[model samples]
Target: MADKEPEALKIRREIGLVGGVALVSGTMIGSGIFMSPQFVMAYVGSPGASLVIWALSGVVAMFAALSYTELGTVIPESGGDFIYILRIYGPCPAFFAAVTFILVVKPFSIAAMAISIAEYAMAPFYPGCQPPELAVKCTAAVMIVVVATVNILNVRLAVRVQVIFLVAKVIALTVIVIGGMVEISQSSAIIVENLNVENSFKGTHYSVSALGMGFFQGLWSYAGWYNLNHVTEELKRPEVNLPRALLIAIFLVTGLYLLVNVSYLTVMTPKELMSSNAVAVTWGNKVFGSWGWIMSVAAALSAFGSLNGTFFSGGRVCFVAAREGHMPDILSMAHVHRLTPSPALIFTTAVSLVVLIPGDFQSIVNFFSFTAWFFYAITLSGLLYLKIKKPELPRPYSVPIILPILVLIVAVFLVLAPIIDDPQIEYLYVTLFILSGAVVYVPFIHYKLCPGLLTKLTTFLQLFLEVAPAEKNL
Candidate 1:
């Protein structure tokens, strides 16, 4: 044999159906359920309309998740919408998506979840007052480092941690549900009044713009249903498990979210719920009495679980983008022995920490939806394109065309409602920043004008991280 081909490191298919369900549900359940119900109530102005919003949001999410199951099966890649957009719309649109996600969406989301974890974890210590900013940030930073380390060391271990946190989250929500049901059965004066059909529906707003924004807030709570698509290559069986996990995860989460919201209403009126910042904590205090700090700890653990899922998926986006030449080459590599995408994980952790430094939680949540749904619409449109234009392509899991069409309409509504009804200069600034990626992409990615300094940096990192370029072992 003259020269044997050098072996390239391959990604291990370590995620099974259970882990897949955990990733999707785990990420969707955290922080949002605890906080977003208030936003939903505020936007809709009544407990009843908010409940409708929550139900409609779940319907929207279920439709969107089913549509994504088809896309994941068709493309069957690691970057979720990024890879789908690249294949269908081409690299330019895909670059805008990757750029927006990397710069704004993923970083702010990770930062928000980490900060939520810190606030709740510290709540028990500082009763009747807010946690210190420094202590919260320090705790968030440590949580970020720990989560990143687990992901960098081994994908399996990180996934196991996700499963554990997911169990904790479900248990916490279940207890809240059971407590609320008990209260409803007792028909306490408060529960009866709040649940009164006439009283509950008293102040529903019918404004076109308000309804749109209300959906925006409610859908945020169901945000991560498509997360499993981000690491499709690592999934055990994309065709079988992708759709199965989506169905299981969305069905379970939708029921839990609705029940949890009803539970909140059973204890607090819409106005009261809207006035409170942490809905879960308030409900816990009412149900658990003075020992409510236990809820805080539970919330923190749940947030930590979502944090791990976000890190797992966000790194894969960067790694896959690098492999596609949208990012630096070094980011595409995996550790030689551990085979984890350590470089990309570290990069995402750093960006998230920087974002956490000045993270404004509410602002991040609103705009994160603005940027996210914009790309979601684009990606779902790709599915329609394939069905019509590229009809010959293989589709292991197919959905009716109407599903994506409906979801795309909802996505467009989500993207435009906020900016149109409430014009903000920041929206213009963010749009410009996303388009500016085209300027950078042309010279750096298209023309291959990577700087000489980057070459030396890549070399140094290659040795320092012990990572080599990856290939499909198949």
Candidate 2:
């Protein structure tokens, strides 16, 4: 008689279709929708042009998500574009993807959401003036900790929290939509008069710089469309739900965003929106009177959900990279009993807290989009390469050949257009930083540098954290 072998630990497939939708749409509905409309309006210079940017941004997001469906299904793994790039392009490109995501894109994005949450949460207390910078930063850091704690505690608990906040944020947006529709129905609606054809497109900006910035800001609202891909292994049925979640989530968000923007314009003129620090609160004041603080509370909840979704997905990138030999072994481990990637999630939270100190919501979005789209273009290019070179690879879900091509074109425009219009030395530095990943990748990742130190660190962390190395789900 032989003793039964101990079962290997793996991330449970606790996320289902509804959870997937919540992760994507709830995350997409985050601080961006609450805050980005004004920035987009500022960049485009008119309600009409801003609306165009929003619609175009939605289209681009949908195309990109659909293209990701192809890759997500084919790879059937977590880690999002990092896994796709690794499979098709190789480890070097994959290493760069991991570095940017773990260091810049995900952390900057989480920081942005945290700041939004903090600003909204602290708004009611501050009254007329902007909250003190230190208070806001401290609040944001606390929020990052809370969200990280929830995620690190239990995966199922985190997903449940996501779904709850998704409902809260959706109800909040619905109130705005209903309020605006009522206003639109009234013949005396000043907002309707403002949207009259002549006024709607008034003072539209046609400059390339303006359009690029507008798209960047607008697209940030749709940033989480591919988030479910990052936790694909935790999904119950990846094939059926991956594309379905993307379609439903993205389409719903597109409609909600358009209506939400209309609602904002109905409440505030472009100048008013641009000048305002908190757009949703202002609209809520007009719509909800002294109860505008309720919107502030709602915005905080919305951003909190967005932060959790980003935290949940972003940590998996680190875990997956480590599991695939791209990162340190500690990151690839799960808590012995909890089964959550606590170490990786904590690592992500620490970086985001640092990012929150000096980075505001707007600047972070600008930088996040620059690095994000650069990797996206490469990841989608990998999809094209997979389609051509590995024709026999099983693709349970697939988009047209032209989909990734069109997305690549848009991605290239997004990466190049803004800087060409007005070159930023920051963007140049960002490029250098991205390229510099190779320096570490070659030595540490390729040559396995300093194995002894890393091994000691991994052993100590594993014991202290009560984590064991995790097995891949599939």
Candidate 3:
């Protein structure tokens, strides 16, 4: 018999530690940080409480990062949480998660980022240019097309673009942080009265319940740390590098987040932060005076960097799911010359542009915040189930039992806090979208669209071991 050739894997493991960290950091530190403070201060009246909320979010994010590290190291594959869920739970739930990503979460997120990018970019040139809404929509559409072109032309080139943007953003933010700190030290800009314990917890106009709602809104800024895992298969030495990269990236971003917020708090009072829509730009004007336009340019840079990196990573989740036969086959198609998932990238960008058309930025963000956290809860539950059911699996990296338990509790709290504070009919709509995937899966699987039983079985076993409790002797 003639020798058979091994099946080709779509992923090429070219991403290294720096690239991996940039992927995570770039996605996590998006326009959320720039815009979230206003919403947060509106809820929690005190600068002190606002800082605490950001810090608490960081702690919770770190725990989730640890849990994911354990999972990524064991499976060491692409597809991220979708792969983990499909292996541990079954095809139906995995299908739903993947559907949610393609249909709602990824598209809205990318669109929102693009819109913010355009808003900041144009703010300087036009000065008071309140372009017609249609013009803004057109600009957003063009940006998406451009981003898609870059990725479709070459995957490595796309990654390089992401790295360069991220480096520039980080450097720019670092300078802002240093400049803000200098202002704090040199000027009597201290508004210590705003940090009073009683005042800190008070809401600007909303009730305590309303403050909780705002905290949920602020929490959205910190939501993208786990995005890097989606591209796990493309990462080199995923077993060791994936976990380390996540830890380092989350820690670095957390510090950056805290410093950025502190810089804002130092230069601008709580009341000022709560009132201004463009808090970062406002602070920049205060700190830099005539040179404040520089800050607006920096904000634009950060927004573009975030949009580019987030779409690049998020698009892979759809591409991989499609290749595995869980999503539409079109998403799996790669450019023959560029060696990238062109169709998927273009599809994601298209959906994002549609979202940008009718939706307000904050509304899109809130909707995504609600839906994305629901998925995170599901992802964490999958981790817990694997730990209990499969004890023998090797975990090169493991989260402490205490941390997962804590994460689960925090995840639940974060999810419910928003619902309790803001009772919305759309929340149920989001839930329905999540469940609708079950409808799509039955026909696909019945027709044997997926890999054969043995392949699935092996994948399941690997997943079970990856998330299971770490062996004592390892």
Candidate 4:
């Protein structure tokens, strides 16, 4: 028998450690750092508390990344959290998660990036020129088309572009860090105040409750480090590379985040950071004098780079889902010659453009954060379940039990804290959005896209194999 030609292994294993690192770093470093400080300042009154929030978020993110490393090494598949959940839980929940990603997470994320890009792009030429809503929509459309074009042409070419943009982003951030440090050294423009834990805790304005709420928001900004797992199949020697890539990426991004936040605080007082809409731009103006335009240009490049990286990685999740038969068949269809998932790519880009019309950047971030964390909580549960039920399964890389437990604790806090503090209408809107996936999942299952008998048989074998002793197993 012919070996079925390895199931059409079209994706080249050209992505090495550098590419893996780039994917993880590029995806995580996007608009979050640029926009999230304002939100963090609003939540936590003092710069010290804000820094603590980011530092704690880094630790939580590291735990989450370790948990994903265990799963990604075991599965070594492309669909990421979707695959992990499907293997441990069942098809129904996994299908819902996958649908939620396509319908909400991916599109909103892309739109958020595009909006950042458009805002940054216009800041220079138009100087106080805010484009009409329609113009912003057009800009988003153009961005989607350009990113899609680059990706479909070749994966290697696409990654090269990702590398260039990611490096540029790093440089832009470094510039800000240097600029801010210089400003701080020159004068006492920046304030450094220690939070009086006792009084701050007692005061309703600076209560522990408020800090906890702020911590959750800070955590959301640092959330996407695990997204690198979605491309595991394309990574060379994923067993070794996946875990290393995640750890390194998270560490680098965490340090960069701390430095960037410190820089923002160094140049602008907390009041200035909080009040200014364009915090980075304002910082640049303070430091560079007449050359503030240079910082605006850098911000624009940073946002564009982020937009490109986001679309490149986010689109892959949908493509992998479609290839697995959990989504529309057309999404699985690749370009015959180029070997790119053209249908999924186009579909994701189209949705991003549509979502760009309605809301500003923060709205999209809130929507994505709410849904992304919901799935993240589910993914962590799946890890714990598999660890208990399939303890014997080979895990070349395992998260220490304490870390996974900590991750679970933090994840639970992240989910509930948002609802407790904000309870913004958008929170309900996000919940409804996730639950809406069931609407499609039910009808699809009824039609037997996933047969009940097959699911039951798979579950039975899994349970039996897990529980059966070595002597009795044979």
* Candidate 1 residue lDDT tens string, 158-251: 8999999999999999988999999888867776677677888778777766787788777777878888888888889888999998899989
Tens digit of per-residue lDDT, candidate 3, span 1-474:
989964433556668998888877877777777778887777766677677878888888888888888877766656777878887887777888888888798888888877767666665555534445666677777777888788777768777877887787788779768976787678744644455566545554445455555656666676667766787777887778887888898888888888888788777877788776566777777888877778777877777777777778778888778777786555665544455766677778777877777886777887887777677788888888777887678887777767777877766765676678667887788888788766667766546554565356535643532211111011
Q: Give the clash count for each candidate.
A: 0, 0, 2, 0
Query: Which segments of candidate 2 are over 4 A away from where they belong?
Result: 1-7, 186-188
lDDT of 2 by residue, 1-474 (tens): 999987768889999999999999989999998889889989888888888999999999999999998888999999998998898888888998999999999999999999999999988888767999899999999999999999999999999999999999999999999988876676336676558889889999888888888888999999999898899899988999999999999999999999999888876877889987888888888778899999999999999999999999999999999999998999999999999998899899888888887887888999999999999999998889999889899989989999999999999998998898988998998899989999899899999989999999999999999999889886
Q: After the best TM-score superposition of candidate 3, give how far the Cα of residue 171 lies from its true spot, in angstroms.
A: 1.9
Off by over 4 Å in 3: 1-9, 125-132, 196-212, 444-474
Cα RMSD (angstroms) for every candidate in the order listed = 1.5, 1.4, 6.8, 7.8
Candidate 4 lDDT score at position 91: 82
Assess every candidate by TM-score.
Answer: 0.97, 0.97, 0.88, 0.87
Clashes by residue pair, model 1: none
The top-ranked prediction according to TM-score is: 2
Error of 2 at 200 (Å): 1.3
Per-residue CA lDDT of model 4 for 80-167, tens digit only, reads 7787888778788888888888878888888887776666665555554465666766776687788878877777887787788779
Most lDDT-accurate candidate: 2
Candidate 3 positional error at 369, Å: 1.5
Candidate rank order under TM-score: 2, 1, 3, 4
